[model samples]
Target: MGLVVSHLSIDCTDPNALAGWWAEVLGWERAWDEDPDDDEVGIRAADRSAEWLFLKVPEAKAVKNRLHPDLRPPDGSDQATELARLLALGATPVDIGQGPEVLWHVLADPEGNEFCLLLRTPAQVRADGD
Candidate 1:
């Protein structure tokens, strides 16, 4: 059988805070009890289909990420509304040479890990045959 993918892991300076921030952004919940001094923290989707683990690291992020998540809005939400909500939740825009006309908005979490907010919702994609 082919290998099954599990959780995505991220290295950060403060696991608890970063994990909490991501949980808020994705509407997920903590996977386990939070310990302020712990070196790792995790959050998972409500259905447990997706998960991300944050690992404590001594060094700060020094460059753009080689890998990052591209988020699309869920069925009931549109890109603009989701973008505003993400900004209000402490996400900052990042310009990684994507240029002005690109279909996605690059943004960084509290710890500078870059991710993209894509232009279309799932429903839009379905309707447009994209």
Candidate 2:
């Protein structure tokens, strides 16, 4: 049998809060089994398809993240609107050496982990028109 990616994991100072923030951002729900005081917390899509696991770590973030989630605009919104909404949710813009021609916005979560927000694809733009 082949392996499949069941979840994406994030390491952070506060797993519970990070998990909650991500859940709000993605419109996903917390995995009912997780507790606010747990070192590990999980969130997943309504269908439980995109599972995300957040783990607490002892060391603070010292450098750039090696891996991070790249978020895409949902069905009806455009990238700029989504970016503004995320900023309101406490995501701050981060400079990761992206040039003027770069097609995505680099942002950091409250704990300073870097992630990208890509511009909407053609299909997503079409969805906006619908």
Candidate 3:
């Protein structure tokens, strides 16, 4: 049988904090039995099919992420609304040479991990016949 995909791990200075931040961003919850001071922390997706694991590391993030998550707004939410909300939640805009004309916005979390907010929500994509 083929191997199954598990969690996506991220290295950060403070796993608990970063994981909490991401949980807020994704509307996920902290994994069961994970404490605020743990060196490794995790958040589970609403449906529990996916997880993001965060591990503590000594060095700060020094370079752009080679692998990053691309996020889409949920139903009833559009890209501009989501961008505004993320900015309010402490996510900052990032410039990764994705010039002005691109359809998505690049953003960095509080710990400097880069992720993208795509231009269209799933509802929009469906409406556009994409």
Candidate 4:
């Protein structure tokens, strides 16, 4: 009676380069290869905890992303700690019109896909835009 997400797929200009960037972020390894002759990469979280797949696409991104993922440190961890870690790993800050008081920091990968670092768990996100 419940639908579960098996994996998250992203379209990128370079699969291998994007996959490598994500692998460093999630501490994941290559899970599988979708094609041998073509470039499609699957990067899975360490211990197979989750999956994120990157596929090579021809079209360039023209507008903001409609959906994005938020990465949060495990329970009891603080956002600043994880933010520093991710920045050191090559993620750059993205100006998404959010203010300093916001609970999440927007960042872009090497290829410009926008993702966020959340200060709280999904259930703890403030409902009101206060």
Score each candidate by Cα lDDT.
0.95, 0.88, 0.93, 0.81
Query: Is candidate 1 or 4 superior in TM-score?
Result: 1
- By TM-score, is 1 or 3 better? 1
> Which pairs of residues clash in candidate 4, taking residues 3 or more apart in a chain or in different chains?
none
Clash pairs detected, candidate 2: none
Best by TM-score: 1
TM-score of each: 0.96, 0.89, 0.93, 0.79
| Cα lDDT tens digits for candidate 4, 18-94 | 88888888778888854544567888977787888787889866667889888877555678987998899888998
Candidate 3 deviant stretches above 4 angstroms: 127-130
Clashes of each: 0, 0, 0, 0
Ranking by lDDT: 1, 3, 2, 4
lDDT of 1 by residue, 76-100 (tens): 8988999999999999999999999
lDDT of 1: 0.95
Better of 1 and 3 by lDDT: 1
Cα-based lDDT at residue 91, candidate 3: 97
- Which portions of model 4 show Cα errors greater than 4 Å? 33-38, 75-77, 121-130
Cα deviation at 48, candidate 1, in Å, is: 0.6
Instruction: Compose the digit string of candidate 2's lDDT tens values, residues 1-130.
Output: 9999988888888998889898899999998676768998989999977898888999889899999888888867889998999999999999988877888999999999999999985587677894
**What value of lDDT does candidate 3 attain over all alpha carbons?**
0.93
